[model samples]
Target: MTYLPLVNGERTYLATWMDLYSRKVVGWQVGKTMEDELVILPLRRALQWRQPVTGLIIHSDRGGQYVSAELKELL
Candidate 1:
């Protein structure tokens, strides 16, 4: 995740999911607030785009959103 400052002084967050081997961004979402949906939505997009089978592993920092029950259930 990354934060960007806008001209209006408010900040926006970008959440991304990248392919580890290719170093390419597979999915991404931008939101005004750092919420679980920011992370979860990108993961959902990545899954549809990549369509990987089982044993898929995801790595992320222990942010509250990343560890949320909603995200865990989806994973």
Candidate 2:
């Protein structure tokens, strides 16, 4: 996740999922808070849109949100 600086030094978070094979951004979401939903929502959208076959792999840095219970259930 990354942040976009707003006025007064406040920020919003952006979460994205990319198709590794195609090098295309498949899903993204932005919000005021950097919670698990930031990442989970994008992944959910990508899965619904792509509907890839079983055994697909999702890769990410070792971010705490990625290991959340909700995200694990979705995966």
Candidate 3:
């Protein structure tokens, strides 16, 4: 995840899910808030799009959104 400053001087958050094997960003989301949904939305989109087989692993920093109960449950 990264925070970017908009032209208005406000910051927005960008979350991305990359496929390590392909080295490509498979999913992403941008939002005004860095809430759990910010990360979850892109992850959900990746899951829905990729539908990878079992034993998939996801890695992320220890940010609040990444460690949130809601996101943990979803995973």
RMSD of each: 0.7, 0.9, 0.8
Best by TM-score: 1
lDDT of 1 by residue, 1-75 (tens): 999999999999999999998899999999999999999999999999999899999999989999999999989
Candidate 2 structure, TM-score to reference: 0.94
Give the whole-model CA lDDT for all candidates, comma-separated: 0.95, 0.94, 0.92
Decoy 3 TM-score against native? 0.93
Candidate 3 or 1, higher lDDT: 1
Compose the digit string of candidate 2's lDDT tens values, residues 1-75. Answer: 899999889999999999989999999999999899999999999999999999999899969999999999999
Q: Which portions of model 2 show Cα errors greater than 4 Å? A: none
Off by over 4 Å in 3: none
Worst 10 residues of 2 by lDDT: 56-65
Ordered list by TM-score, greatest first: 1, 2, 3
